[model samples]
Target chain A: MNKLMVYMFKNFIRMLLLLLFVSITAFILVSLSPIDPLQANISQTALGSLSQEQIDKLEMYWGVNEAPIERYLAWVRAFLHGDMGTSLLYRQSVASVIMQKLSNSLMLMVFAWIISGGIGFFLGILSGMNRGKIIDKLIKGYALLTASAPTFWLALLFLLVFSVWLGLFPIGLSVPIGMDAASVSLSDRLQHAILPAVTLSITGISNIVLHTREKMIDVLESEYVLFAVARGEKRWEIFRHHGLRNILLPAITLQFASISEIFGGSILVEQVFSYPGLGQAVVTAGLGGDIPLLLGITVISAAIVFAGNFIADILYGIVDPRIRKGARS
Target chain B: MDRIPILDIQNLSVSFSQYVDMFRKNDLQVIKDLNLKLFEGEVVAVVGASGSGKSLLAHAILGILPYNASFSGRMSYCGEPLTQMRIEQLRGKEIVLVPQSVSYLDPLMKVGFQIRKSVNDKRSKEKMLQTLNRYGLGEEVEKLYPFELSGGMARRVLISTAVMDSPRLVIADEPTPGIHIDAAKQVLGHFRKIADDGAAVLIITHDLELAIEAADRVVVFYAGMTLEEAQASDFSDESKLSHPYTRALWRAMPQNGFRAIESIKEADL
Candidate 1:
């Protein structure tokens, strides 16, 4: 237990250092870009008659007039004190704006994760158990097809079929335009979430299914599995007792490693569906040169990636006893 | 000596279908015309070099051969035909196998739970602990995983797992390799005790000395065929061995001066 605590502490330190590095890099890159946030903000408004004095005041207020390093250090200081600065694009606190969008993205991610993980695991076991059979072949075909198709195109295709033609789901937005979100029914939220969630899930499912199938096949052929069979353990019993944990350990590592890809893929899907999620938020922030909002989103996203890996490492220690021993000694 | 044999295998042959190309297929005959038997209260050791189909014989009896391997054989256990279904039913209860690979233990499982085969009852748990104790393993060892064990401990755990139910028949495939000499002797001694308790033990090994020391009978295999079957005392002198290969193996023993013979390849056999 002390060893596990030390392991977690070390990983926490590493995650903090990585987040710092990401923040610095994001700040520097945004500073080096040609687009000036004040100019972008000014151009976005209908203020052709505004005086130069108003522009100067706006620049001072936003700290754009300060040296890039000075501004970054000030931002970091405030961030450490729980202030993520005000967004130039939305004219709201970056934290408040991101919190609203973060929840929406998390909801989409949770639904996609559960759907993809459950289906992928089940299909993978079936395909692996019946290798070279028709079910295996069909799953392989689906994997190949989804792997080749782009996420945005798939999302659009879903939208066209389910929304435009069939009218099964809403075309865009996470909620009805006129309906108050707080007053909306649970079924209304689910109906609005289905298209974007499914679009995000399909790609993840394909990747996970292929990975799980490969790992399951390898585990099924291992000496221990064969030994279990020789002991006359029933097929399901062998799978449950021996096969599932072994296969899932590596599969989970792969899943967590692919989290960045999933995050990136969700951006395109979110755009296609106009879902008010972090992915869509990041895209809008980037285009509008909202550096503060972009920096906030980037740091949070990197933190999410690091957290995923950290969770995977902890799970590794739990699942494989060798890892726990290694952590101790 | 008229007791019905616990296991009787006659004219057992195993051949595997192999794909030579996309078009051509061939049958690779691995074992042919092998015959062996084990009566109650006896330990029989099948001794041969690697690739001599010794392991395949054990797998065949256990009905765990690969999907493509086809075999023609008559195998009986306790005076009844040992069909696949019957073997499946009897396995882990009436018959058990101690596999050769240390990798055969599940890496994720606790030693005690695995030995009990996940039977959650208090009786089985106590029995599992007793089996581990008989193998000279401490109670704490039950909580350790396969990776935590030394080679000898792992071998003992495998033995403990097989004998937990006091199986009627036990087949151990190369159960002593890589273990210390004393540990090997201890394992073989345990097999002797199992036999004395009325279970038939078949040990497959390449160590002729161990076989001669531990087993009541020795069956020699050469190039996937049974070369000779003899009383273990027959191995005391090279001249008492009936087959040239058996005599060659005896002479090749370290105690017998490690005599060298002309290389006889599989093609020559």
Candidate 2:
């Protein structure tokens, strides 16, 4: 128990450092970008109509008049006190906007994650067990092709085929247009999420499949597996007794690590589908130069990705005693 | 000695199909005309240099040879033809292999559960404990994983796993490499005990001296063929050994002046 606490505490320190680095980089990059918030947020006509006094007030309010380091420090001070500030474009608290959008993104991401992991794990084991056969070739070819394919492009293709061509699903968005948020049914939300989730899952599936397949092939070729085979263990028995536990640890690690990929892919997927999730909000906040909103999303996403990796680390100790012993020592 | 040997291999040959060129393939024979018999209550060691098809012979008997390899031989287990299907049925139970190293034990599995395989009944657990105890391994060792075991403990665990089913034929392939001399002898001593308890033990190793010490009979192999078959007592004197290669091996022993033969080929011998 003491060892576990130490391990977790170390990981917590590492996560804090990573998050700090990510936030600083995001802040610097956003500050240096060419997008002028005054122009990007307001039209030329609206800017021209404003008097010098009104323009000065707007610039001061947006902290455009402040030095980059001063503005960053001020934002950090506010952030530490649970004050994420307001989204200039949304005219709402950045924290509330994030909370609203994050729920939807989590639903989409979790759905895709489970689907991709389930199908990919099964296919990986299948292809690895039947290596060099036609099924293996087919799965390998699919993984190769999909791994190189871009998420936005796949999302567009799904939108075209499943929405425009077949008319089987919505073209975009988390809820039906013109429907009240309180009135929307679970089935309706599920229907709207299907295409986006499917697109994200398809792109995510390739990595997990390839990694798991390689691990499976490695396990099958190991000396212990050969010993199991020589001991009169049949195919199913070998997989159940020897193969599964060996492959499962790596599979779980890959599955959790892929969370970052899934989140990144969700951004492009959300754009193509115009889904009103955290991914779409990131795009909106970035374009509108809503620094507070952008930074909040950045910190949260980084935390999530780090958490995914941390979970994988903990699970390694649980699944394999060898690693557990190493960690304890 | 039993009238029918536990395992008999006659005129055995093994070859693998390999692609020599882009479009051409050929069969490369690795073992030829190898013959040996392992009777009940005896330990027979097949001693040879590495890659002399000693391990291949073990794989052959267990029907675990590589897919591309082909063999022509007549192998019988207790007077019955040991066909592929028959070996498969008897594998892990009536017949078992004590693999070369602890690496042959599943790294992810507990030592006790691994030996029992899927038999989780209370009685099977008791038997597994008994088997471990027989190998001087305590019940506490059962809960440990393979990596947690020391070199000697790992070796004992392998031996325990093999004898858990009370197999009639036990084939050990290079069971004591990279271990201390004392520990190796202790491991070999376990095999001697297994044989004394009425199981036929076939040990494949490169250490001729160790083989002679533990085995009742030793078969000398050279370039995939059995060069000589002699009683372990015969190694005490060069004259008692028939083949020149076998006699050269005797002279090469450290106890006997450690004579260095310039070459091991038949002509040189």
Candidate 3:
């Protein structure tokens, strides 16, 4: 229990550090970028032809005149209390906008991760067990191809193949055949999300397959397997028990990072398919220079990434003794 | 006694080959017709210069030989064909190896974990500690890693792991090398108790005096073949030896208890 307490305290410190690093870096980076947030906003709004006085008033109103540190601190302070201010273009509270689209992104990402992780784990185990066999060769070839291919390009190509050429599904929208959002079934929602999810899953599956395979190879060569085999343990039991436990540890940790990526990285798929998601909100806000919304999404994305990695470390500590020993909370 | 040895070998040849050319491979023959045997419950020691296949015979019997080594002819364990048995099954539960150095174990594993690993039961943790205590290794040795253990303690722990599983045959390779004689004797004494428990122990070493004092029977090896086989009592009467190599090795041990021989001398003795 004392050890658990120490671990928790250390984890809290790490969480704070991750938040600090992400927010500060994001703040500094956006502040330094050449794009004029005011101009970027004016061009997209009725305020484009306004006087310099109105622009000054707008800058003062938005607290853009404040120091970057002060602005960042104020933003963080507001975010902690669930107040992310309002977008200049959309004129909606950042939180409300995020909540509106969070579900779509979640639906796409969760299913993507499940599909990728499940398939990757099975294929990895298969390949590792049959190292030089035909299945191993096929898995290796597939993993290599998917990992090297750009995800955004894959999303575009998939849109062409599945939505355009086949006419099997709608191309750029989450609804089927102009159906009202209020009447859409859960099955329809999942069907609409499938292409995007597949788009998101390709590289993720590749990463998991590659990592699990490498770890399995290492585990299979370990002395414990030899010892286990000496005990009359069947070959499949070695794969299922000792081999799986050791290799899955690293894969489990990777699972969290993949989760964060799916959530934060579904932007292109959402855009190409016109799926209303937090990713779409962020992309629109970023390009249109909606300061509050962009800053809010950036901060949230960073937080989610930080949270995913933190959870991974803790979960990994539980699974792997090597980590559990040295990796304190 | 039955005429058939507990472990018998006839023309047991082994080799390793590597691809040296596009259409050809080079073969390295490590052991040639290495005929030898050990009896049940006997503490038999094999001693020679390094690379004389003292370790290879143990590997061949246990079927833990490197992938390259192609072995031929019969090598049996209690009249059972060794080559045919699953290599992994023969280890720990059947034939355990007390390796030359204790560092051979996975360094990441705890001493107790390695001990438990040999027995294949997670409850082997508590059981191993109790078994270690029976062999005179106390409780503190359990939590420590292999690096933290004293040379003597490490050796004893290796033996503790070996016998924890109660194997029928324990092939120990130089169980007491590079340690002081006092520690060596202490370890050898432990080996004797293990042999007394009705297990066949094949010890490979060059320490003639240690072998004479500890082993019930000694099989001497030179250049990958058995040179001589004799009972421990037969050593008192030196004329009973058959092989020139065995006679030379026996003559090489210094008469003084602690003092080792200065050098081995012979013009083909």
What lDDT tens digits, residue by residue, belong to model 1 across residues A19-53? 99999998888888777666666665645666788
Model 3 regions more than 4 Å off: A38-82, A176-179, A319-329, B11-14, B18-33, B48-56, B78-81, B85-168, B173-187, B205-212, B217-269
Candidate 2 local lDDT, B136-206, one digit each (tens): 88899989988899888988888888888888999999999889989999999999888888899999999
Give lDDT: candidate 1, residue B15.
89
Error of 2 at B148 (Å): 1.9
Which residue segments of model 2 deviate by more than 4 Å?
Answer: A326-329, B18-27, B180-182
Model 1's number of clashes is 0
Model 2, A1-329: lDDT tens digits are 98888888999999989988999999999999888889888899999999999999988777787899998898889988989888888899999999999999999999999999999999999999899999999999999899999888888889999999999999988889999889999999999999999999998888888888899899988999999988999999899998888899998889999999999999999999999999999999899888999999999999999999999988888878988776767
The residue pairs that clash in candidate 1, if any, are none
Q: lDDT of each model, Cα atoms only?
A: 0.88, 0.90, 0.75
Mind sharing the TM-score for model 3?
Answer: 0.78
Go through the candidates in order and give each one's DockQ. Answer: 0.66, 0.82, 0.27
User: How are the candidates ranked when ordered by lDDT, highest leading?
Assistant: 2, 1, 3
Candidate 1 has a TM-score of 0.89
Ranking of models by DockQ: 2, 1, 3
Candidates ranked by TM-score:
2, 1, 3
Q: Which residue segments of model 1 deviate by more than 4 Å?
A: A24-82, A179-187, A251-259, A325-329, B1-3, B265-268
